[model samples]
Target: MMNFSLPMIFSFFMVLCGLWSFVKYHKHLLNSLLSLEFMMLGVFWLMGLQLTSVGMEIYFSLFFLTLAACEGALGLSLLIYVVRSHGNDYFSSFNLLSC
Candidate 1:
């Protein structure tokens, strides 16, 4: 039986906090992006701990981190584009249905 250590519990709460923050403050694009990153990091932490406990390789965690970085970059680019064109990053101000 695997023991649930303090670090693992902390990581689990971290992920929960991230999700809560994402849902509570999703109006601004920047807040949403930051919350997403927070969730990714928390997941990474949990993955690393679980893999280490199971004596499994950590290559998957590295791949996940790489993908997270790519996602962050893409999100930032989108934010920049929105801010440049609309002068703000609020979803309510940016109309997606317009041509």
Candidate 2:
């Protein structure tokens, strides 16, 4: 069946990684952020697999990859700032909204 294809396998792996990241996030900010990225990658791959046209699918995949890169860059920059301010990246220490 089509469900047993490579794309499905990869997508399943992505979900598993995302779940692991979410679980790890409670203990570390970096882990959570990376987990979010893992989930995004799954979405990107699925989007590419949904289309039938090879040319169009490639374009969509490229677009998704670009978005993913942007996300990683922004997340990394934010992480850098947070680490500089707190000397570490931990979810429990984040209380900017508690004022």
Candidate 3:
């Protein structure tokens, strides 16, 4: 029988929390961004685990994390723009031609 370590357990838990966050709050754009952050954290944890398990560096994972951060920043910026123009962050309020 293979034994699971603490890191593996923690990684799994992080993934579960991330999935839960995404599922529990799907309607709000801010919440969706927060949930995506949580999911990226899970990816970070999994990358760490893979690094330790395989004795290899995770340069690509770090790059992926950076990309995720950029994506989140852009998303939030768009959300802010929408809110400033429409007075609300609801998904249904976006109309490109009306601007």
Best by TM-score: 1
**Candidate 1 lDDT, 1-99, residue by residue in tens:** 978999999999999999999999989999999999999999999999999989999999999999999999999999999999999988889777873
Q: How large an RMSD does model 2 have?
A: 2.8
The best-first sequence of candidates by lDDT reads 1, 3, 2
Candidates' lDDT values, in order? Answer: 0.94, 0.80, 0.81
Collision count for each candidate, in order: 0, 0, 0
Please, what are the lDDT tens digits per residue for candidate 2 over residues 1-99? 454678767887897889886886668778877898889889777777766423453776788789899989999999998898887998678787853
| Model 2: how far residue 71 lies from native, Å | 0.8
Estimate, for each residue in 1-99, the C-alpha lDDT of model 3 and write its tens digit: 756888878877887887898788776678877878887888787787777688887887888889988988898998898788988876667777898
In model 2, residue pairs whose N, Cα or C atoms come closer than 3 Å (at least 3 residues apart or on different chains), thus clashing, are none
Judged by whole-model lDDT over C-alpha atoms, candidate 1 comes out at: 0.94
Candidate 3 weakest lDDT stretch, 10 residues: 87-96
> In candidate 1, where is summed lDDT lowest over 10 consecutive residues?
90-99
Q: What is the TM-score of each candidate against the true structure?
A: 0.95, 0.75, 0.79
Better of 1 and 2 by TM-score: 1
Candidate 3 stretches greater than 4 Å from native: 1-3, 92-99
Model 1 clash pairs are: none
